[model samples]
Target: MVDQKTPADAAASRGRGGAPAIRERLTRRKPVEELVAETQAAEGTGLQRHMGFWQLSMIGIGATLGTGIFVVLGEAVPVAGPAVILSFVLAGLTALFSALAYAEMAGMIPASGSAYSYSYATIGEFMAWVCGWCLMLTYGVSVAAVGVGWGEYINELLHLTTGLSLPQALLAGPMEGGLVNLPAAAVVLLSMFALLGGVRESSRLNAVMVVVKVAILVMFVAIAVTAVQEGNFAPFMPMGMAGVSAAGATLFFSYIGFDSVSTASEEARNPQRDLPRAIMFSMILVTAIYCLVAFAAVGAFNWTGFADGETSLAGILTKVTGTPVWAVVFAAGAVLALASVVLVVLYSQTRILYAMSRDGLIPAAFSEVDAKGTPCINTLVTSLVIAVLAALVPLGPLADATSIGTLFAFALVNVAVLVLRRTRPDLPRAFRVPGAPVTPVLGVLACAFLMFSMSLSVWLAFLAWLAVGFAVYFGYGMRRSALERV
Candidate 1:
């Protein structure tokens, strides 16, 4: 249990030597019981439980499906050749490990904080802060990254339909020789408006978009698979296993938001019953669709041609059909696909901050909700910040940074599963990761394996981000924590 540190308890701890007292404070775990109590405590004034299995599944599928399939394929195919299909499979397996652990934790804890709250309940405060910090980077920056991808398809759509596209000055960031990415900024703000309206409405809209995008991809597969050139499959592993591993690391960004379903715990009507099923089901369905698209795309077009960046899959559709109509249709689908990603990821970002702020780790403003049970101030402020990042940051750096942070967070979650199983054996868990120590151990190793594939520059950026997080914790969260103040 997370014992509240009264003045007397603090005094007693201080008497037991300074170093020991500090260590005790840092490793303090929050009780699962109390976490649930707080959920009930804030119900009428905080997030409402409006999500079901269907809405939760949409959160995972919408966030994962179209983002990487439509955007990253152009980048990843060049690196891994036709074997980019294997990269998708490799990335999917890595995500499966983490998803199993997430299912167990969501069943036991059911907190909106996602991996952050799991760490707080299983490990301690310091680790929880680290996980929350990484999640902030993972979800927030990824929304911007996907927003930039949204701009790519929007430009493609205009070019296909009207023979005119937005100029470079309005299409990219300073690093890419453009003034600002206007479409990126515009889409994020539009998603923000949707979020501020309410969670149920936002989710319903996302479900519709998910159906549309799926149909579009299925249609592409049907048309493109028939035109497969046998020569395209030769020399598949051009750059070899290293290239496949590297591409897998990059493609892993696509799987980043599947766990957003776990983050929706507090908003789900039956978290224990629905969250676990949704996580596994969504991951399986998305992986099947992703691998199918990659296989069809590679078979239909020479892998080398993907490097040309002509919106590969859409371009392939147009090539096979002998018309630009398919490209236009595909581009329209991409717009909706990426917009769905922005909505789900942006929603995850706000909820994680809400949990942190409620625990006094950040400002209390983040925890405040309006009559409709939305964090009005939190949504607006986060949306504006993300919109700025989308507008000013280049997609490459944003994507690399997001993947590193997301990998770190997923590794921590795997460790949390091991920690909780040993520490809280009596806790009632609705779902369980099958292989115990072995499974959770492999999950951690798999996450680290992919994380090692990133470039040195990306690793340096990850360390710098962590350094800043530590500063914030010591400067603000350390003393202001609710565990201490209570």
Candidate 2:
């Protein structure tokens, strides 16, 4: 017994059905098939797959197309002038770099955790936990971000219909000197009830909502184009590239939800093929809409007129058509659009948390399924948290924070593709990023450039968030992780 083991014996022990050394435990990669098997084995309890190509595509579009165009265009135009169109393109290009990577990974892994799950199978357990933490920030905070936008537009509808505007104190959050954001809180609660109805029902509702919102945007493009003034295009780059970059960084938050499509891996009818298609299609459609809307907005109205972007489209419609009728209609459409965002993104937030829970990184209740084939406890808890934030926190800084977290998650996803390709070249990929190391490398650089464009305050806030995540991981996830028991 004391004779000791050979190198082969030592290596064999590492692959045995048990936990290895602490260092090995931290870096252990969950096998791709094992990831799918765990979900398949729990068939009765796991999330059911029902969504087809169009439904999956709607989830991405519904979530990705809101707020960015509805509310952000107003905020962006003031900074970038007519160049805001360029900002939208820049952000879309940055997102495309990462989206290609997401398509490759989603086709291979097809797990609910998305980038977090992808990181686990390609990177390691520890990195996966941190990635999940960033995703929590991305989806959870964006719910509140879009909810606040919903509240703003709902107020616009009220003002248009009855000529009564809600007081600033009632509409704004505490940071903005308002006591509570009632509509913001109300929208999230409504979305929670919708989720409790089950994924199929919710997806149907989201698809209808998506159709209405997209039509509204198209109406804006048509009506606004009639009033386009060539004179407005004279100083297109007034603020120059610096302003364009800043606006692009801010607008990056708008592109966060396309990844929500990947989070549907376990719910998609044919994730291996459909997920990639949905993600790419959503990006192209959303980007075209963004550019068209920005172009029409600046052309139809002076960039200086976008003083308050929350209701920019409605204002532009009113100014162009000279009637509050079209404005009211646009405002109503925005209410639908932003609500759709809350619904789809809330669904995404729950699924990501559910994935983390199954890995033993969080409470088990999140992973538990209800009779309706949904995570009731998880949905209820996430909705409540997001509702509170929507009611109390201001939107600007939170939106920026969401962008940074989203970019951080996307950058890691690009890295994961490169890692997996090199480590397991034999793994089958239904979709592949064309240029590999070079493409992913550029994605990383693009994300980093945009991140650096943020103000120092945003960086400080993000680092504070990362610190708390590290604390949670070391204190609980490390010891309780499912891998530790393997």
* Candidate 1 lDDT tens digits, 1-486: 334668776677763443236776688778989888888777777889889999999999988886688888888999999999999988888899999999999988888999999989877999999999999999999999999999998998898899998999999999899999999999999999999999988999999999988899998898999988889987989999999999999999878888899889889999999999999999998888888888888898888888776656778888889999988888898899899999989999999999999999999999899988889889999999999999999888888899889888888889999987887788888999998999989989989999999999999999999999999998999778887654
Looking at model 2, residue 185 earns an lDDT score of 93
- Clashing pairs in model 1, backbone N/Cα/C closer than 3 A: none
lDDT of candidate model 1 versus the reference: 0.89
lDDT of 2: 0.90
| Alpha carbon deviation, residue 383, candidate 1 (Å) | 0.4
Worst 10 residues of 2 by lDDT: 1-10
Relative to the true structure, candidate 2 reaches a TM of 0.95
Q: Which 10 residues in a row give candidate 1 its minimum summed lDDT?
A: 13-22
TM-score against truth, every candidate: 0.97, 0.95
What's the C-alpha lDDT at position 454 in model 2?
94
Off by over 4 Å in 1: 1-12, 15-20
Q: Quote the positional error of residue 458 for candidate 2 in Å.
A: 0.5
Stretches of model 2 off by over 4 angstroms after superposition: 1-22, 308-311
Q: Which candidate is the best by TM-score?
A: 1
